[model samples]
Target chain A: MIRLERRKEPSTFWRVANPFLAVILTMLAGGMMFVALGKDPVTAIRLIFFDPIFSAQFGSYSRPQLLIKSAPLILIAVGLAIGFKANIWNIGAEGQYIMGALFGAGVALAFFPLQGWYIFPLMILAGAFGGFLWAMIPAILKTRFNTNEILVSLLLVYVAERILAAMALGLMRNPDQPGFPGSRDLRRYESAHNAELIAGTGLHWGVVAALVAVIFAYVMMTRHMLGFHVRLAGQAPRAARFAGVAPARLVVICLGIAGALAGLAGMFEVSGPGGQVRIEFAVGYGFTAIIVAFLGRLHPIGIVLAGLLLGLTYIGGELAQMMLGLPSASIQVFQGMLLFFLLALDFQTNYRIRLREEVRR
Target chain B: MILGSINPAVLLAALMVAATPILLAAIGELVVEKSGVLNLGVEGMMIIGAVTGFVIAVNTSSALVGFIGAALGGMVLSLLFALLTQVLMTNHVASGLALTLFGLGLSALIGQGYVGVTPPRTPKLDLGWLSEIPFLGRALFSHDIMVYLTIALVAGVWLFLSHTRAGMILRAVGENHDAAHALGYHVKRVRTLAIMFGGACAGLGGAYLSLIRVPQWTEGMTVGAGWIALALVVFASWRPWRAMAGAYLFGGVVVLQLNLQAAGVRIPVEYLSMSPYLITIMVLAIISSGKARGSLNAPGSLNRPFHASN
Candidate 1:
């Protein structure tokens, strides 16, 4: 029988290898699921894992969609990863995302029928501020009252959803479309629209922001004192305290940054691909970003790649659903499996397995 | 006359029904936390239980079997968690989050064909003569057997945690796993069992939602009930009786808000829809700020993964 033995230092090999192994395992498991659902597992798996990138028919269209989807995910996850590094959980980025969209849309709507360059920049600032303010509720509560951030952040998501619905139905509804429960299509407004920076490519302000965030995060994580404190805080709280890291301040700053980034993602999506504020505007990006954060091993650069990979799954999962008649829920299951296997395999990084003869006393 | 027409007995009955799922889940989580394991996958497990119960109940035409299936499904899911956190010694928070996502997806996959299908109705308790009591009977005694079971489970949990030797060991493990291990207790084993028990209760809660409350299968019908249950456990300060009370209070809010919406009260439906979560958070903030010792009651090893080795 094999037994796991503790290791003095975590294995660097497995630390890098586990995510790759988990991906393979998820494919095997997901393929079986597809087979059970009466679909050709090979074709189904191909569509999900490979076709979006390689298939001639889908590749041209799907390629652009991948970047479009990955931008917000990467942006949100970058912020989340930083906070998670500090052992601060900001599970309510989804709520902050919604509020950001609302705030950005509010600014755009306020300047309806007007043309100005300042409007977009102003909306971006407002959107980030909106998310920041929303995140502060949990941060302040946690710092002052010592409440759990996880529950508070998550609960705020439901509240934010309700507010989003209210805006779609009431305050933010497009005046021209008298009966529709959606705000004006920001895509149609020239000054307010977050249009593509490059023709035929999916390059937009959001994509630029995501790249900038990634580079900034990479630099901060590698070279900054705050980053060292965050890593120190997570690894050893008492040591961090002795080293003069104020836990409360770190909590607020980490959460604030995460919230702002998530808000920017929301604002970008609303102006870019999402086009307008609607009841269903907050698609599960905030939630999905959690997976991105972890799969990237909380590394900024790794997060970008993970975001794109997950984005492929989203596009490919949809393709499989349409072409192979697979259930949409299968994708969610597939994503969950990735995390499960990664966590399970993470055991190997910290321990070694050995086979030993039965010990006879 | 108008106030009288808004019958308190009916409102109380609805409140109990609303509370049962959360109460069951919270009490189960209380035990898990008491054993030094925190499983945040309650929502995932509950939804899985819901779908499993719904599918089984629809196919077998038996609510009892449905609940069994739900419990099994939840336990099975929790076992994955046990393996990850207990055996592999992974991060509890990450593993729990993964479990929730997995449960939601798995339930949806299993529930694909069962969408819009009605579940076999769970029978309300028939206490013959006792049912004839004017107000109390209808409010308290008229619920489906799960409601009574939930109440009994709370009492059982309270007794188990406070009085029994096994309960003491579990609490000791939660308080300080290293010390408990030094005393020759199997910390991992105790935690695994606690996680499974929590999973089973969350399953029952999910089953109750599908078979008794909503009485139908719907994707994401559990919504955020599992999260609410998690919050309730904290609001209760990990106490069984207090958990039940928190559940009832939350249930009361839910029932009241729905009633207000149905009665066409002047408040926006969106605000009413969000009231329960907002109220829970507000209450949580208030309770947390009141006393430092209150939060300290949380088991020391609550979210920490334990390994026999250093």
Candidate 2:
């Protein structure tokens, strides 16, 4: 019989190795799923995992799309990881993101037909502010009224979506295109446009912001006192309180930072790839970022890598849908499997498995 | 005149149908919480159930069999959660979140084939002469079997948690797992069973949505109903009867808002659509702000993974 024995301290080797192991396991599971769908598992896996990066046919187009897809995910995940580190769940980043897009779009629309050098920077600020303001609803409620942030944040997502739909259909609707439910395409607008920074590389201001956020998070997590407090709070609340770490303050700060980052991502998306404040403006990026945060082991650098990996899956999954006749939902299931295996195999980091016969009577 | 157009009996009947899915899911979560496990994957499980029930009912043409399929699908999905948190000792919150992601994806994938397909009609209960009786009969007895089943489950859960010896043991296990373990109670087993029951109920709730509520298969038919159910459990303070009441109240709000919208009320459609979520958050805040801690009655061991050995 096999038995698991608890370890005094978590295994450092397993801590690092488990994520890689989980990826391999997910690939295998995904292969089986493909086979079940009456496709050749090997070709499907190869197309999804390898072809996007290496193949001459799809790689050029997909490689650029990878960065485009990952930028917002990385940016959002970086903020989420900060709050998650303090055990403050901010599941409503999606709402913050939508609000940010609206706020940024609202600014651009307010200055419609006006040419100004300051427009872009002002829109960015408004986007961040909008997200931060939306995030405060749950943060204040949680800190003051002791409400659960998870539920409050999540509920806000639905509210935000409704607001987004309203904006697309009513207030933000493009007057030029009567009867259509979408705003002016910001990409076509000069001052507010978040144009690609480099030719054909998918490198935009949002990508730069994501990179900066990653570096900023890395520095804060490893070299700052607040980071220490966040870690301490998550690990032990009582001990943190004794150490003079204020829980409410931490909650607010974490939520604020996360909201701002998510909002910035949304603003960038709406002005660049998304093009307008449409009905489906808020996709599952906010929710997917949660998975990215955990998959990255809540580390800034790890999150950067996780974001790119997940981004690849998004591109590759689309490719599969188009090329292999695979269903779109398969990619979601594939991503879910990664988290499931990661969590399941995390057991190895904290415990040792042994044969039952090895135990002393 | 707007109020005059709305019949009280019809509104009440609509409210009960709207409430049944959430009521079923919340009561299941109530038992899970009472046994000291907080399974946040209700949304995921419910979605999975929704797809499974829809697919089976479409193929088999029996709503009863569809519900059973949904329950089993939910239970099977939740077994993964139980294995991860209960056996592997993973974090409940993270695992639960992952479960939701997985369930949503899985359901969407399975539902691809069933999209736009109308489900076999779930027959409403025939109370014979009782149906002729006025407002009470039409409002209470006219719902399909699942609606009545949901009400019965609430009573059953109340009795199981408050009066039965098994219920006492489940509560004891949740209150303090270590002490219960010392008393030779199987903590993991009890919690696992509770988790499975919660999953089944979530699935049944999902099935109801597909089979009777919406009565059609859509990619994401549940649309945060699971989250509402989760909020309802907290608002009810983990009591089965209160969960039912909270569900009904939410349902009433939903029905009222939709009716008002249809009647050309001045309120924006978006605002009306968002009222249920907004009100839920408001109620949660109010309850939590009270002198009593919102989660005071929460099982002491809730969210803490149990391990038999050090």
Candidate 3:
């Protein structure tokens, strides 16, 4: 028989090791799934986990794509980690991201045919503000009415999706192409474009913002009174209240920061890589960021590393889809498996397994 | 007045059809929550059931077998959750979310080949004399077996929770697991069974969508029904009969919105489509805020992980 003994202190070794262990487990399980799909599991696994970063065939092209993909994930995850620290769940980052894109794109479209150096910067602020505004719904509702944030925030994602469809079909539709339901390609709009800061390197303002967010989060978490209160609130709500942490204020602050950062990610994405406010504008970055937060163990620097790793999978999953005729959903299943293993292995950090004999009473 | 173009009988019938999926899913969740476990994976389990039921029904040419397959499929997925949260000691909320992501991906993969393929038809019950009963016949008796089964299940659940010895024990576990455990009850076992039953019901709900409602396997087809069902539990205040009422009410909104869109009632299609979700949020706020006593109905150990150390 096996018994689990709770540890007084979580094992630091296991905390560091479990994520890597989870990754390995996900690979083995994912390979088996590929085999079930009637494909060569070995090649599938190699392509998804290794080929993108190591192979000569796909590495160079996929390398830059990795940073592009990870940027938004890292940025959004940084904000989510803060709210999660305070035991506040804001799973509606996807909705916030959508609203941010709409707001940012609205600015550019309103300034159509105009050229100004300040336009892009103004759009960035608009994007952040849009996300903050969307997030404030749940924040205000939760603070005022004592509603559940998770359901309220998540419900808004569907609402946001509908609004996005409306914009694509009506408000934001490109007049230049009458029948096409999309906005003017912002990439070709020189004045409002989020062009590469450096040629061929995929370095953009979004990457820089992600890095700044990382550094800022690291500083705030390590050296701020609010950070202390956040941790205290998550660990002990009653104690935190006694220590003068206003739960309502913290809810607003955490949701605001998360909303702004997610909005910024959405803004940078629309301005740079995405370049259009279409029906499919909001991908699953907001939801994926939740996984990124946990895989990184809710730490700032760890989120960066975790984001890059998931980013690699995104590029590699695409590559695998192209090369092996693998279905795109396989990658989603792969990410889900990765999360499962991560959660399952987390047991190791807080408890130790011991083999023992059962004694009958 | 704007609803003049719509037929009340047809709309009421459509409401029953639309409400079945959420009603079935919510009733099962009611049991799970009553047993003190919160599984936010109703969406995931439903989709898995949808795909599995579709696949099995298509291959076997039997809708009944398809539903059984869907329930089994959902049970298997919830077992994974039980393993994670119960045996492996993972966080319930995180595990539930992971289950959803995994379920969506897995279902898509399984459903790739089955897309656009038609499954066998599910037949409605023939209540001979009741079939000719005016408007009530079309709105109520016209549904297939699952509709009556769902209502029966709701009544069954109410009886099970309030009348039976097992029901009392389950509620006891939900109200306070530590006390239940001290009283020599198997809290984990009771919870696991409740979770499995929930999965089966959610799966049946999904199969109902694929087999009777939309009657097709579309990717991400359940939309936000699962989440809405989760909210329904709160709206019903954890009472089974109230959950049925809440489901029908929400379903009425959906049918009304669709009818309005079809009637071209001047409202944008997008706004009409978004009304259900917005209404849900409004209802949640009102219910949660107005009845301070309502919070007491939530199981005391709803989301808490339980471990028995001998």
Candidate 4:
């Protein structure tokens, strides 16, 4: 009987091809899910994967929307990918994102009615600082106390969400609107608003920043010493230690960067499409970014492309929800399936599929 | 309202009831993690358990059957997790996260029909005369059978970890899978079993929420309860007994918050609502200080993937 054996080094061919193979499998499976839901499977599949960027009827508007929607996902995922590469799991980017919005909105709300562009920049900085501060909690705890960062960071998400609710209903409630559980509209604030520079297109500074993040991330992973350390630590922790990569420092750096990026994404969202702070401002983008990071193979360019592809799904998923009566949660399941299949197919990298010999009884 | 002195005793009872779900789930998770599997899908499993238990109980009118259904539902989900992370050697972290996501979606789908449907009440186990004693009876003896079962589970798990041969083997596997594998201990089987056990406990916890606590089905009823259980595990320092204490502490915080709200305390409802989560962070920070010190029982291979080559 043929038996499977692992290679000393992984196959480069399968390393790249697996993701593509997984995507095709996911599409076919996801199409089946749509069909099972009673919609025309082909049209539904095209809507989810193709229509957003290709169909002449929707491509123009959807193309720009793709960039707009992907901004937060790419920025946050790029930061997270570094940590994932280092085997540091920070599952509370959603919390960091909320804290960033809270802090940035606090700044913008403080400077309301002032028509200075500096105010907007200041708010952005504050947002980033807020997320950084929140993230540092887990980082410091993990390094200093040997506490599990996974638990620490993730639990903080609930706290952040509750704080957001408090701010919306109590601290940040609009003075003009009575009994409404939301904050002042940031977009309505002349100086601090993050509106589009071009008409009809949703392109904003946030999208530009995401593109910049992609470039920086690409460089950092390929050329920076820290990136190598991250990869080293994840692949072989003992070997990483031999190379003088400090685990504590790596944890702090990865967490700090991730928190800051998530924070900036929050700030941009609060200023841009999200428009204002509300109890429901968080739409699960932080969690969704994890999928983006993995789907992109944790490669910066791949993350950028993956973020856009995911963005397309978000838009198209909504379209199908309205037009075809498809449940929106299917989109979440579909995203989850992609990760699951991507992981299951990873066996190909190390071991070949072969018929197994019977074990000695 | 009964004109009586402030029922600190009754208040404590509420705390115990509130903490049961977290305690049960965390204690179960503690055992699983001891065997070296980090199953973050507890939240997903719990929610499915919640809905499944609610649906079954509503239809059949039996809390006991509902608990069984919840456990089975959770086990079914765990099977998927086992297939991917154990059999396929996928990254445990990603797979667990995916399991959680799938659980969330599947629960939402399963809960569609059950939303707003009322579940039959979980009958409290009246411990006869012991339950009638002024403070002790009300606070400790009087509760649903599941609550007592949870406390028993904690003690049972604690005993197993400290006293049993199998426990030692399970611990050995978590500490060093390669060595355990060489010793002919079925590492994958142990981890998979632990994961299933954890899933069942999480399902029971979810059932408590639907069948007793809220007594109704909901879309996202378990909300961050699974995450809270995860935090409880760390707070317990991965010890079965300490998990009980942490869950109770968290439960006390929750009960007190609701009490304050009922009393119309001046604090914003949001801050009051956030008290449990905020306290969790504070406690985590305090415990996590000094060194990355985990419990002695914490599995050595907690997040590592095991592979054998001859």
Clashing pairs in 1: none
- On TM-score, who's better, 3 or 4? 3
TM-score of 1: 0.98
Tens digits of lDDT, candidate 2, B214-238: 8888887898999999999999989
- Cα lDDT tens digits for candidate 3, A1-361: 8888777899999999999999999999998998999999999988977888789988888877888899999999999999999989998899999998889999999998899998899999999999999999999999988888989999999999999999988898999997888898999898888888987767899999999999999888889998898899999999999999999999999999999999999988988899898898877999889899999999999999999999888888899899999999999899899999999999988888877754343
Per-candidate TM equals 0.98, 0.98, 0.98, 0.94
Which RMSD values do the candidates have, in order?
1.6, 1.2, 1.5, 2.7
Off by over 4 Å in 3: A357-361, B290-292
Q: What clash pairs does model 4 have? A: A145-B291, A145-B292, A146-B291, A146-B292
Docking class of 2: high
- RMSD in Å for candidate 3, one decimal? 1.5
Between candidates 2 and 4, which one is better according to lDDT? 2
Q: DockQ scores for all the models shown?
A: 0.81, 0.84, 0.84, 0.66
Q: lDDT: which candidate is best? A: 2
Tens-digit lDDT track of model 4 for A120-236: 889889988989999998898888767778777887888898899888887788988967879889888988888898966778888888888888888888899988999999999
Question: B1-310, model 4: which lDDT tens digit per residue?
Answer: 4223347888889999999988878987898888888888898889888888888888898889999999988878888888888878888888888888877876776677777877887888978999889899988888989989899999999999889999999899888999999999999899899889999999999999988988787777887898889878877878888899899989999998888877777888877887787788778766665543544445678878787775
Error of 2 at A129 (Å): 0.9
Per-residue lDDT of model 2, residues A171-215, tens digit only = 999999978999999988999999989878899999999999999
Model 1: per-residue Cα lDDT over A1-361, one tens digit each = 7777889999989988888898999999888888889899899989987898899998888878888989999999999999999899998899999999999989999999899999999999988998998999999999999888999999999999999998998888998997889999999998889998987578889999999999999989899999999999999999999999999999999999999999999999999899999998987889889999999999998899899999989999999999988889999999999999999999999988866664222
TM-score of chain A of 2: 0.97
